[model samples]
Target: MLLKELVDTAATVAATRSRLTKVEALADLLRRLPADEIAPAVGFLVGRARQGRVGVGWRQLSSVMGEPADAPTLTVADLDALLDRLLTTAGSGSAALRSTALRDLTSRATADEQDFVGRVLIGEMRTGALEGVLLDAVARAADAPGDAVRRAAMLTGDLGETARLALVDGPDAVAAVGLQVGRPVLPMLASTAADPASALEVTGEASVEWKLDGARIQVHRRGDDVHVYTRSLADITHRVPEVVDVVRSLAVDDVILDGETLSLDEDGAPRPFQDTMSRFGADAPRETLLRPWFFDVLHVDGRDLLDEPLSARLAELERVAAEHRIPGEVTADPAVAERVSREALAAGHEGIVVKGVDAPYAAGRRGKSWVKVKPVHTYDLVVLACEWGSGRRQGWLSNLHLGALDPQGEYGEPGGYVMVGKTFKGLTDELLRWQTEHFQSIETRRTAHVVHVEPTTVVEIALDGVQRSSRYPGGIALRFARVKGYRDDKRPQDADTVGALRALLPGA
Candidate 1:
């Protein structure tokens, strides 16, 4: 497909405010694309190189600049050298320099590169601005039903492939392809039931399994080799070696198991979510210190259980886990989960996830089929000066007049104490006392009502609820928000942005 064709499609989607218009535009593009150009066509739609998901990093625009430290100093020096030129010179401020840069960028950049630039300038990078909406567009373009495209994309996670089947084969193409061997199925997740009655109504006669407080992992083992992926499907096999050992110990020669990877303390209780997340950072040791507990199996020996009922799959999971002594379960009773949750909380672990006993793996979604009920506490808050945050928050100072940023946006705007928010929920009382002293130093003005600070100090802010408010411009107000502590490790510009504040939608 031509680059202009894809650009037009993306631009059309972005310009159209309604979902209906976006879908129609996307479908129109798909219908017009030649069959042979399907893969490239989707590539155009994504404004990315045509590469498999497993190999997307090198295809990334920034990745084209080169690896960190090794990356170019003045300009992006690799495949994105052209892009670097556009970005570096795009902001000369000097009209002549700006004109030259724009001219050069126009001549040097590809059609897709132009689209990327347009999106970056506008702060909307992903195709159609939303993945779900775009996926629907791809289906419509192919003249296929949305369900078919959703299933294909969910199973494969390859928008390009999904686009292909949706365009050419229409809906039902996924089912017609027979079972995909080696292709991973999307894993299922848990949801929360408003109450026990609702939970029971949905479960019917099915069983409920306790959702453990741990990271979700997809375990793939074939023969003696094993691979593990995080919920985002990032390859983490090397980071969690203990999981590999467990899979190797499994009875089946080749099996794909769905489960959780959690850091269990010495007392056998899960650790903090932050701790679990931090374990796989850039600085984490490339060793298997994490533990993985198996819960379900979606594939075994090339046979797909995706269409199979949970009851049958549970039997398989039970047999394999038991035969191999892998940590997993098959019983639907909530008692085991209740015990797990109680024990987990006693040991400072997060609450449990209750899963459906018969649901197929519904990857890329969160619904009642899989339920999660975590215990979160709330605190009361007092409104301070509200300012904009950075990046997406440049004009609004959206960050809470946060007591803190790394500076959570408590900077002094011209007329008032404009700050985003502040927080260091990890700190102790000692930190809070230290923050008050530091905040006093930055004080520019003070009143009986509000103490105007220089925005130099930031204190951590924590709250439980948000209510509609005339107090804030975003049409909402914070509840139980106050300084938990402070973080001096960050700068004020590094504070939260207005975008973050908007994310606190009630239902969301």
Candidate 2:
């Protein structure tokens, strides 16, 4: 199939707000795809490369200043082969080779095709047809049950392959995809709750466990071979040998354990999340080592626990990783939930997760089966700038750039503020209007996407916690930050400080 056809369909998908339209367009595109092209087609539509992060960065892409062809000539297979060469091109003159390859590819593409290619290469499709919508499209095209398709994709952690199997081999083949010992499946996620009592009220008889502020580790063991994957399913087995050794110590011949890993202080308390990420993201040697704390087991000794209830999974977890199991209790009592939450916080952890005892793990989806409770921290932070919103809020200053005062010059100049993050959450149309008008009055400078304003406006922001940041000057950034409301009465200097945020760091 032509790359232009796919790019045109992506534009149509993005132009419509109706999911039904997106699904229909995608399904039509899928029906036209030959079996050999299914994976790359699906990958491109979903804004990912089948080759995966082919050593291309925005800087390299920015260098490809080519005049796009007025006509379409690139094929889907053509782009795929180009990506293959880009990924494999390396050695001394590799930089020049990459530049040449990118230039040639872009020069052959039309303007729209160039935009599509850029978006796919940068990993931001923005077509409104993400994995969820694309999964529906695959199911529609294959005439298969959505659950079967979703389960196959979830278990294999490869939506593109799932699409190929569902289209080429039929429903049974997709259904045949199951939990394997070494291949990482997508980790089940939790929804947020106001408190432990609220969380327990939703889950009933539950397994409440510490929600550590650490990297998620999915440890899979088959015989002596063990692999560790992150929450996003990236294998990081070589980064932490200690975890591999611990899983290898397990007597079970084959198993998959879901847990968190972080480096703790000498007192056995969890260190700041930055310290954990520093070690997790590093490829170099470090003195600090991460320790794993298992909370659930998906497989044990070849028996699949994925379809089993949480109670059963916990039992298997206890049998396999009892010593490393996170501190928790099984109860329906709110008092017990509250106590466990307090205990977790007292232990220098972030929060607690309450799991329904009878609920099976719903891989890759955030269902009501699991709920996480954490104290919300809100601060009157200054708005450094605002970005032009997209979609419904287009032309409005929607995303607020947030900053924290650094009075002591700990992060930057004395008496100035350091940027922590940006968020457009919790904004109503009324708020957007107010910000658009208000920010323009104090606008100091402007860019195509951002309106820089004098840091005089104070807005209240809420977040889950903070993480260590190399991008921000303060060496920290807010996690899950959202705007609460504008604090009209507060001055910029009266806003929260970097020190105040650092105090929220675990074990601080």
Candidate 3:
């Protein structure tokens, strides 16, 4: 298939912002792909392609393709060619190409359609939902089982492999998919609900395990061999070797356990997220130095226990993780979750992910079934020009330039707004490194952490509150709006709309 056709389909999907349309676009793109290339293509889209991390953005892709110019230009056909190069290199390209390839495409996008294509390429394809929300759409389009297909893709990080197995070997391959990698069927990932009332309704129980804020690790054991994967299931067997040895020394032989791995000091105090992130960023992560706290279990003794309820699995995980478990842990009832949450925060974690004992493992699903109760604060802000980022974050143009919302158009200068603040906070350093590289690529001028881009990526920013200010584009300032992480699950258009800003004023 021609690259233009793929772009057109992508454009159609973005234009409609319909899940069905996006799935159809993916289906069309897959049909044109050779059987062998399908997995690589999907993996490239959803799974990241970075060293130590999963994404290096377009620059990495461009470098992989050997595109001319420090920053390359990409045509639609360029994506397929780019994928071919990535697969040929096994996605092991110099940093330059991978970063440029995605950005170059994003740089030239003029329409909503192009933006959609760009979103998919970067794995930011959020239409107000998580990736799993679209799995059913994909399955419907491809005429396959949504659950099996999503799980297979998670295990292999390749939608094409899932498709091929479904088409060639039958549902058996899809069923046995995670097993090939020695994983039990995918483990359930948990989150927390914002409202305690909502949490009670969802779990239908007075008991739950408040979740932790850290990287999710899934450990798969085969005899003595151990492979560990992140929440996205990318193999981190090398970066987290202590985890490998920890799992290796565990009492069980064939099992898969899910847990959180935070970089903690010997005192068992949780390190700053940055310190923990730096550990992950290290080419040689000191596994012995890196502490992993096991939280849950999904498989044991060749039996699938996801259906066995959280209470049973928790017990099972503890039995296997006997030697390697994080000490002083117990199942906290729902009423005490508030107390547990205090310990999580006091220990320097974000919040807790509460899980019900009776809930089955719902792989690749996030809803009230699994809530995410992030402690958030809101701020009213005006959109300013966007900027880019670096390293693993390259080509994203993830950073933002902010100003207070100027609703009256009351500025004496160009529209009455001032650039008051800039922040790289609330983002994983992985996010930071990736954005740093991205900002560098699109930099109009450079002196330090600032690089201006087209005012294309707008966002609804939440901060602890505002402070009196004179330094930034806005005379008034946001106390902590710092990139507050990303709105990848949202479109630039969907940013907190201007009408909503009035709520911040006492006498609006």
Per-candidate Cα RMSD to the true structure, in Å, reads: 11.2, 12.3, 9.1
Report the lDDT of model 3 for residue 250. Answer: 72
> Which segments of candidate 3 are over 4 A away from where they belong?
20-34, 40-138, 154-156, 168-187, 195-198, 210-213, 284-288, 322-334, 372-438, 441-479, 482-508
C-alpha lDDT score of every prediction, in listed order: 0.53, 0.84, 0.53
Candidate 2 weakest ten by summed lDDT: 485-494
lDDT of candidate 1 vs native? 0.53
Point out where model 1 deviates above 4 Å: 34-115, 118-129, 168-174, 177-181, 194-198, 283-288, 323-340, 377-424, 427-463, 470-474, 478-508
> Which candidate gets the maximum lDDT versus the true structure?
2
Pairs of residues at least 3 apart in sequence or in different chains that clash in candidate 2? none
User: For model 1, how does the per-residue alpha-carbon lDDT over 130-186 read when each residue is reduced to its tens digit?
Assistant: 556668778666666677677777778567777777677766775464334345555
**How well does candidate 1 score on lDDT at residue 187?**
61
TM-score on alpha carbons, each prediction: 0.64, 0.78, 0.64
Which candidate ranks first by TM-score, i.e. highest? Answer: 2
Cα lDDT tens digits, model 2, 1-508, are 8898898888787666677888899999999988888999888876567797676655567679489899999999988998999999999999999899999999999989988887677554546566778899999999999999999999998899999999999988987888988898988878767788888889999999988877788999999998998876777899889999999998799999999998999999888655776665558887888999998899998799999999999988888889999999999999999999999999988779999999998888777889888777667699889999988898899988898976545566544578988889988887899899988766657898999876767887879889888888888889898876675434465577788777667776
